[model samples]
Target chain A: MPARADATSPWRSVLAPSWSLGRGADPLPTFVWPVASAVLLAAAWSLAAGRFDVTVFPSPLAVAREAMRMAADGTIWEHAGISAARLAAGFAIGGAVAVPVGLAMGLSPFFRRMMEPFTEFFRFIPAIAMVVFALIWFGIGEASKLFLIAYNAFFSIAMATEMGVARVERSRINAVLSLGGSRRDTALLVVLPSVVPYILQGMRIGMGRAFATIVSAEILAANAGLGYLIYSAREFSRMDTVVVAIVALGLLGLAADRAFVAIARRLYRHTLPEEFGP
Target chain B: MIRARFVEMVLPYLLSVAIMLGLWQLAATQVNPLFFPRLETVWRSFWSLASGDLGAQILVSLARILAGFGIASLAAVPIGLLMGTVPAVHRLLGGPVDFFRFIPPIAMIVLAVAWFGASDVAIVFLIGFSTIFIVTINTEAGVLHVVRNRIRAAQMMGAGFWQVFWLVVLPSAIPHALIGMRIAMGAAFSTIVSAEMIAGDYGLGYLLQEARTTLRTGNIFVGIVLLGMLGIMTDRVFRFLIDRFGGEHAGSR
Candidate 1:
């Protein structure tokens, strides 16, 4: 039999300076566009807000100074940490439950029939609409906020998992079954392995949804977390703090997403190139 | 077989609602109206809201969503095409764009409130920003997915960069862009209510929030339903466009 391709072979190329644009490849242009766009936006804001002479539209410099002060006091970090914890907790809970349910639904028609309808129904309904119920079911606290994130995460992840499992080639399943493996064994050993790539992809997308939902949940309620911090800053008319929070949220979300992509590459080393290549 | 499949989809949906309403009706007999309103009374409220001033609020919310989504598509697609066709450009901006994409657009609500002062502009900005990220990413991805071999073929035939891009790349990327636009439209609509909740003089989100505060459960239900229906309708419109223009050439790579 032919030897299986070594998994570690590609990482060497990625890490080594084998590629022309190697490790020092700077995403500076990406940064510049958003920043430039933001500045242009800020300028536009100034012109528009300047007309009213209202304090709410503080100069961008004022927002920057307030950002620096929040950084000095470490208040921003604390709030960010709280928000991150909520995001992680929700992601963990939703991912764990949805993965298994997705596997079961994919494997059995009966389970899929019983569950898919209910899931899809709720899935189409906006997460924000569930805010009222979250407040009622879990009360106005961390649990409610976490549930909202979890709610967004679970449906997307489960559907991904189900689709992933279902999409695994029947040939692969038959190959395992022909080896005298039971249905359960073939599913666990053969189908599950192939489905990890899809699961990871789903999780990446879910991270986007969950991240967005968490902010809305926090805004609706909660005293801590980044959303709360920003809303508080707004109430105090601290445009700087608001700017900082906005930058912080954007940066944190981008970082988390990149981290997820990196981990996905590390996990599914062999298929990464062909699957995602542009 | 098609009939069976249709029944399979429809029956469960009907059953779930029946079960939910039945439980709600039963629970209302024991629970307080403020916390848990009667299902029948809620139905009555929904009817009134559907027929009254609440309908205008729904229109306001829908209009804002359409305006924001329309603006996002106009701005994002051209820039996305540039990034996708140019590797050097993609290499530079891809990293920063990916990072910020995750930051919940919700964080911008504060800035929205601060800068726009709870007006239509602020709401539009929030919707536009959220939709723009997804549209940009998808547009870029779609462009990348256009077969490199095809581009080379076009170039061999003396196609210029712009010609190769417009002829080969843009057509291939449309479906993905449309998909992203669809998702973004949904996201924009979802956020509109919340955005409106803050400083909205009128809109479904404002109305829903108001109904909740006023203890009008039925109106809240109506607002939620109207929003969902609008979302579904928008999705259908996008689907129709994709069918008409894209013609399944770019459905889902």
Candidate 2:
């Protein structure tokens, strides 16, 4: 249903200022709305936490205390560092391999045909299944964790790279070829520029998958990392610690995503598309 | 030409499978049978699962996936529409929602367990939560992209708010919503195995885990195959629905 910001509706009138929706200089009022919303959300959370009086549902204050405790004990930083390092490692490795392989598949029909079945089959196999093999192959160490993340990252990047290559203007390639450009030169000059945006997009996607895999792999079997911290907290019913870990996860994930987009925007300032998500 | 076209498509797939099986069979014979089951053994295992209690496990897993995916759509689509239609609301909620979207669902599994306990509801919620953001963003984009002129025209023509939304926004957004749902379905399926791995006593994931522990390579292989087949079928159904709606929408266009 189309929602009416009707004059008669007091809730709308009070909650949403009339002039905020207007054009030009009026957008400022609307821009500040989320601050009010943040306050409201926090208040609601506090109220619900208090009202419920549930053991698992720790109040915000309690979570803050737990956060402080973890900080004081120095375990939080250790776990956070471990998780971050793993994510970085996996993302770098996965991006490197996947982008190259994806480019190859996209540019070469023979390569695509050869790799298609393996990629499709492996794509369907859950990372958990790979963890079993990783444990067997890498012996339950950081390698296993990195391998899982790398594997997860590979598919997203590969798909994106293939898409980017497929979408390269055919005319541009033909023009380059007509100009006596070699295959390598055509790929470097014509294809790479067009595919850069998609490669970045694929990296963004791969980061999400890599992060997910890292956390899950860590949680499944690890002595260190934020995943292990949360698992440990859960084991002891330390709801506050668990909450803090989750909040940290949310923050890190958000930060990594924003950082990628910021870099992409900065690099591709001229040709950047406005709408992108997922 | 038709037969040749059919053969062209089929031959590559067959060749790939035959090569894979031949390699696996070689390894199975050379290596230990327990570690690397032969293709024939895996086929037998697949049939056994189809005929036995394994079918229930597959059904249970499918039910969980459907439940999670269904609930996510119900929650995401309406809210996405609201955000899409209202610029102010979208601006406000978009940042926070996007933040939550990136947080790996597995990271939240610990919280999910604590919040809802190790029950089916928690598993379903985890799967749903994992997939919701993609659907929300997609749906909102879909709705927002609905031609502004259409909305304005509807408003000008004595259409009420609801009527304008129903007549103009909903139809335009359906295609996007469907795409989001399809993607989210993939996400839901991707996460279901992990959710089941952690919390369930019975499911395809649970069965796969058991197979791993027992070193029943054949059974594990069978489980993996089923996961792929199930995922493909789920996608096919989603596509069918999209095409059905898309055809009518296309006619209008």
Candidate 3:
């Protein structure tokens, strides 16, 4: 399949440069260095733990044990699952609304001018700052957490969609129209397909923002999730549990990002026009 | 013609703000005041706070962001330059940098609080730690984009490596570094807010938390609006600096 060529395609920009850089590297040294550094870091941490106060900074082994215990009892899974579900629902809700609104904005100059300032202003407002407003409006329920995540994701997706649509090739649309395609057909088949990669790029960024917001929201006002786990453990001075929660959050973020990459790859494979042959 | 064009350009923004305020007022009247304060009430609170405690909180948050962002920029720029210029250094540090980059700064609040004990140092550490990776990566990217021919020309002119790096490479990379610093500033600003909400006593984040506890929706709105304004104002300052210092590199990209 042929990928549409555009200077503003973020996915292409992110992936293209790295591939060329990786070609000449020896794989063995590459693997050895990262693993060696990981081992070195662990050794250093262990040494520091032995010298310093364990209450403040637990050993790597202690953290591993805590993680195992959490896993054995399924507590870690419960927290992780709740956080993941919230992230998914928020991304879905935000992306669904943002794409259509962004399309309208991209297609109509008047609409774009009307919405840009308001959205831009809100975009600068940290999602963390909205926790209180969310709490007041939605209370200390799942709604508040979801709202925070969705709000953060919405602006990112909307901006990405608008840019993507605005950058869609005029020639492609003209060709479609000359081929007897209606205006609606040109929008659905030509413009939307061309902008899919940009929308996906936006979703990727939005997912990261949503994860960050969820952590803050949970810390501020939640009974569950990884943020809550870390906060509650900290309250009791459980440094080991805190480390375990941090590691868990990192791993979950990595997993979700990898999942997104895989899904995006599949979508690109199916949707990219054949003329821009891959 | 020019006047009409200017109006056409500006009218939508004004109309949009008006429409939003109108809708907000409409909603306020329908909902309970506790949940959604009237627009006028929120506006009054905004004005009062702007002249009082909000100014102090804004200063506190700004100080924290600057401290953290300043430290991150100082550390990241040199290291990023080294990584870009030296292959061995990049290989040695790239893995760890990428790993830490995946872990959001918000997740580190727990560890930060534990290590630094809810002090300004903890917030600074959180912001700095989160920002360093971004600045480093962007700096490296910027350095990599520097025209190799220019460096070779400097070398051919009998300039030492340090001289070439300081004079040729550094100037070319400044724009990207500046962009990274702007991004880092934004990140630090938001991270400090979250950190404050968790452990602070006097920042805007703390004020928002306090307002939430007191069920003062109007005060919460004030805090949010103030934060938005602060962000916009600081961003404008960065844009001005970038344009002033970046020269040909500022908007060329």
- Candidate with maximal TM-score: 2
Of 1 and 3, the candidate ranking higher by lDDT: 3
Which of the numbered candidates is closest to the native, going by highest lDDT?
3
| lDDT tens readout by residue for model 1, A1-278 | 00121234433322321111223443344465556656666787678667653446666666678778888999999999998899899888888888999999898876687686567556766777767767766789778887887877888888888988878888988988898889988888877887787777777777777766777777777788888887777667776677678778877877776676787778887765244442
For residues A171-274, write the lDDT of model 2, one tens digit per residue.
Answer: 99999999999999989998888787887787776776666677777777899998888787777788788778878888887788788788777888877544
Q: Which fraction of the native contacts appears in each prediction?
A: 0.34, 0.38, 0.54
Top of the candidates by DockQ: 2
User: CA lDDT of each candidate?
Assistant: 0.73, 0.77, 0.79
- Please, what are the lDDT tens digits per residue for candidate 3 over residues A22-138? 224343544776777788789988998887576788999998898899999999999999999999898888888889988888988889999988787898888989888787787
Query: Over the full model, what C-alpha lDDT does candidate 3 score relative to the true structure?
Result: 0.79
After TM-score superposition, the amount by which residue A245's alpha carbon in candidate 3 deviates from its true location, in angstroms, is: 1.0
Model 1 residue A99 CA deviation in Å: 2.4
Order by lDDT, highest first? 3, 2, 1
Q: Model 2 clash pairs?
A: none
Give the distance in Å from residue B47's predicted Cα in candidate 3 to where it truly belongs: 3.6
Task: DockQ winner between 2 and 3, please give it.
Answer: 2
CAPRI-style docking class of model 2 based on DockQ: acceptable
The residue ranges of model 3 lying beyond 4 angstroms of the native Cα positions read A1-28, A265-278, B152-160, B245-249
Sort every candidate by DockQ, greatest first. 2, 3, 1
